[model samples]
Target: MRNFNKNALNGKRAIITGGGGLLGPHHAIALVEAGASVTLVDINEKGLKRAKTKILKVNDSAKIATQILDITNLNAVEKFEALQTKHDTNFDILINNAAVNPKMSEIGGQNSGRIEDYNLNQWNNEINVGLTGAFICSRVFGSRMAEKNKGVIINISSDLAVRAPDQRVYSPSESFDDIKSYKPLGYSVVKTALIGMTRYLAEYWGHKNVRVNALLPGGVFNKQPEELVRNVSKRTLLGRWANLNEYEDAIVFLASDSSAYMTGQSLIMDGGRSVV
Candidate 1:
């Protein structure tokens, strides 16, 4: 990670979806520190406000911008290309970080479920963000990056893909981490789909010099219930949820030249949760 310096992201531009949420602001903070001009996008005005305020506090001269956008807005996403041209600006990095999780999932946190019971509408919503959001953003920002012949993308992911089977409360043969994380069956399925999408983009864009990757994060502990956390931590080697700041360096590295040659891969940082 030390191979990357403060100016590694200098003069670069980034757009982080879900910028008002837990991981969004941290991404903004680290990018600004690394010298990237960032645009934080979210559907919530309050979140956007808080994110911008926090970013400016870190660097008075930070080149940070905020946009109120719902990633699933098909018309807006479709027109993004023309919009960028009209504004005389283009994005350099696209972070697909926005999502609507278990609140819509059918499992409703029951800690168990059958895939057949999945909610179709909820599944669509999750897939819309995980896949379509990334697709549209990639097309928009990626076009500009392709023009410049260089760019990077980082999709926020989860460790559920390879999380330890032994740690699950239910039978190992009957994994239900998704049911545990949020309600509904599609949560895990969508995340797994994201990994596949990342690989496809990396392969398709390699010759164009644009890299796409995913970061499978551990349970982020802020506002988490102690009991809930302890239960989750046992599966992880670290035996604890991640502090918000813990994600900063890894994200910065992926956004910078430090991991230029690395693409189309999932970087799992679940405190060894997958190994237990």
Candidate 2:
């Protein structure tokens, strides 16, 4: 309870993308508990229902709303602006948590035999969801923040953006390949680019007191079927995948006043996977 008071997010208005995903649901709860009104955005109706239900069970009266729309649709984004105006609440924090991968992993290089099926077309499809979706979210939300010179934009990224990847999933793996790791063409590339965009927006808007940053969360471990999360724990220095709860503190830090003066930096929460 003491921790809650030290850095609470009381009375803030937040918009979260990907709120239906594994990490997004938990993130939404934490924000609401901190006294913020949260708007959960996702394309999955079922996930949205589950997310909203869980939040209400905790508080039974949390000010939470869910918006179902395809982020890829620019028209929908325009409408989002209108909805915000109607509510008379300018977004105080924007979390770009929604993303999609068209065909699993991305494969690159000459020996890209595994992800051959994962071509540029498939790559772009994932990029549109994984990266471009966040791009537009940030574009509209950050633009609003610019008008007031105050807001926080937290972008969720994966460690694969900086670490070596398992190429076997997307492409082929040589028996004796020293590099061992294979990079996906779409997710890794787009996520890496996302960090760049975060930095650019941070620098561009820092003068106005708007903080733009990225949260490169390590692989999220949940009930979802993920071979990477299941099998890769042995490779981690901690020997365990990060629980979904591990992300809450990082969220509070970035969304609360604690991270004031920080911008354009990535708060990576991987459990030593990148270190090794």
lDDT of 1 by residue, 1-276 (tens): 223478888888888999988789888888888889898988899999998888788788988888888777767865755687688677778888887654222333433334555556667887888778877787777767877888898988788655432323332233554334333455676677789888988998889999999998877777655545656676668878788878888888888888988999999988887765
- lDDT digits (tens) for residues 1-276 of candidate 2: 214543288889999988987778778877887888899989999999999998899778789999897887778986897778777788999998887642223323443434645466657777898788888888888888888888999988878777756543322332335432344567777778889988999999989888988888776555433554455675678877788778877887888888898999988778887887
After TM-score superposition, the amount by which residue 32's alpha carbon in candidate 2 deviates from its true location, in angstroms, is: 0.7
The global Cα lDDT (0 to 1) of model 2 is 0.77
Q: Model 1 segments beyond 4 Å from truth?
A: 1-4, 103-118, 164-183
lDDT winner: 2
**TM-score (C-alpha) between model 2 and the true structure:** 0.86
- What is candidate 1's CA lDDT for residue 81? 55
What C-alpha lDDT do the candidate models reach, one value each? 0.76, 0.77
What is the lDDT, from 0 to 100, of the residue 56 in candidate 2?
93
